[model samples]
Target: MKVFFVTLGCKVNQYESEAMQKLFEASGYVRADEISEADVVVVNTCTVTAVSSQKSRQMIRRAAGANQNSIVAVVGCYAQSEPEVVAAIDGVDVVVGTKDRTRIVELVEAAISMRNEELGIRNEQPLSVVGTVDEIRDFEELPHAPQRTRAFLKIEDGCNNFCAYCIIPYVRGRVRSRSLESIRDECLKLKAAGFKEIVLTGIHVGTYGRDLRCQVSGVSGQKISLVDAVKTVLDAANPLRLRLGSLEPVELTDELIELIKTDERICNHVHLPLQSGSDEILKAMHRPYTTKNFAELTARLVDEIPEISIGTDLIVGFPGETDENFAETLEFIQSQPFAKIHVFPYSARAGTVAATLPNQIPSSTKKIRTNSALEISRDKSKIFVERLIGRTVEIIAETSTDGLVDGLTKNYVRVYLPDENIPLGEVVKVRVEKIFHDGVWGDYVD
Candidate 1:
């Protein structure tokens, strides 16, 4: 049998899809290059926004229409949040949620068996295996699936914070951290697989180990933390580079900061989501930190790590955001030493508190603010990359084509080398020469 996969949303979702693919491949199934050729089709969904949910639905329908005989399976956050809706969709044979993905292959096999037993007749109801998100406690362990040059190791799952504008907590459940032993094992496997970089990803990465008792060898009963997990990965894998996923500002403790400062293997880049810069809008959105708190944290990081790159997520045209509030946000963003800013127009999800709040911003207004913030982001990115000119930095070559190789720096700068012979997945030092396209052009330092 051949299987095809359609993955959507965050890195976590991508990791899960890869794990599921590994399971299918190991079970004597071939991977299909096209959707129409597969015996089974898996549509991994995302529901971070209403648009994402719509896209998931569209993809499912498209898959179903493309291959009538293929067993169409839907999984991930969108399925977890609305199992009945997904199951009711035509051509869906199996519907599993965010959890219990280790059983994906078995579920698909059962679906295939049922279809054959029914003489190829389509079933009215799909086999759905969604459970309540809140009841989940322990992290589900999935195998390490490395991408081309970098390997993503998920160390944590779920979220405890119920941000007013987020629907993630409803679908992902409370914080459930992976065991320290699991982290070490995965790191060792990635190292043995010759992966040069390992990125520790999670729904709320900074909240890793918050819900778990110590499982490390030396401290069995003590409370574990993300710092401990990082130390474990470093000790076990010793990869050429280690990068962290998106982190909450409030959870970035001083100890973790110190570790990043001292450990050269840890990347000098951090993606901290500052959803909105206006304190009033932030409070309305139920974010934990204030503008003052955010400023202090960024300042401290810059003061200690001079070459660090700090990236942030910003939401513009939030509900009840007056002209003055928007001015404050723009001014705050301008004053910060941000290397890159991901500008998002406020998207009020259906189940989120912000959706029911008064004074919803109009779509036209949101579009205007989004464009303005994007302009600032372009300027900030240009300035950040220009500063690295003439400096030598290491990048693991991720792509090579047409006599050019491209990779990202420890500080998150994309550097391009005009050499096709450079092996992909090998970390090479290059001195920045000039600004090229979206990144900087560099010459091999060796």
Candidate 2:
């Protein structure tokens, strides 16, 4: 049997798709390069915004239409939250949500063998959040283990924050982390698989290891906290740098700051999500941390690690977010001068508190705010890249692009070195010469 996996949304979704691919390979299913050729095509969906949901629906129709009789399946966040909505469409044969991720291979097989109308799986499973932080499963060993320069190591899953404007907590359930033992073992496996960089991702990475929330750090040799899990892995690791995905500002403890500062293998980049910088909007969003604390944390991180490139996500036009509140967020972004800004205009999600809230901003205003933020983003990014001129950075070459070998700096900067000899997934020192709003160009030194 041939199967195709179509993925969308965040790193967690990507990891889940990879896991499903592993499941299919185990069941004697070969991966098909094209959706038309595959007997079963799975559309891993993301519904963060109305646009995303629309795009997913379009994919479902396209896949189903491409091959008239092909069994089209939908899974992940979108499928979990709105399975009936997806199934009501013509193409989708099976709809599995976030919980039964490993069951895709079987479900696909069953769909092909027995044609049944299992349309609505929405809210069919347990309403209570289900997952374990201690029992970590790294499906990296499955066949076709992501052949790439950068690998995603999912150390954790799910979210507990329940941010008002977000639906991930509802779709992904509560926080669950992979075991410490599994993490180290997987790191070794990725290293052996020729992956130079590993990005640790989850819904709410800050809540990692909350089940037990305590462990004896080998580096400390003391009964320490769970926050040191990354540190412990770093201490034992000989692999290249490990980068972190989006982290909540509230989760940046003193211990974590110290770990990044001391550990050479830890990347110098941090992706901190500041949904909104205005305290009023933040409170409305039910975010745990205040803007004051977030600013203070940013200052401390920069002060301790001078070369750190701090990236963040910001939401504009949130429900009840007044002009003054939006102004506050813009001003804060300017003050912080983040290396990169992932700007999003707030989109009301169904079954979320913000959906029914008063003072919903017009879609026009949302676009305006998003555009303004993006202009600032370009300027700030250019300024950050310009500062790297004449400095040599350790960059892992990803691939050759337009006659220049492109890669990422240890700080997550896209760097282009003028050498093709440097193999993909191999780290090399490159001296940066010019900076563009898009990326940095450099000459490879080592």
lDDT of each residue in 332-434, candidate 1, tens digit only: 8988888999988888888888899899999898888888888888899999999989889888999987889999998899999988489889988999999
Clash count (model 2, backbone only): 0
**lDDT of the candidates, in the order given:** 0.90, 0.77
Poorest lDDT segment (10 consecutive residues) of candidate 1? 211-220
**Please, what's the RMSD in Å of model 2?**
4.7
TM-score of each: 0.96, 0.89
- What's the lDDT for residue 203 in model 2? 77
Name the top lDDT candidate.
1
How well is each residue in 322-398 modelled by candidate 2, as lDDT tens digits? 88888888888988859999998898899888898999999999999999888888889999899889988888888
Clashes of 1: 0
Top candidate on TM-score is 1
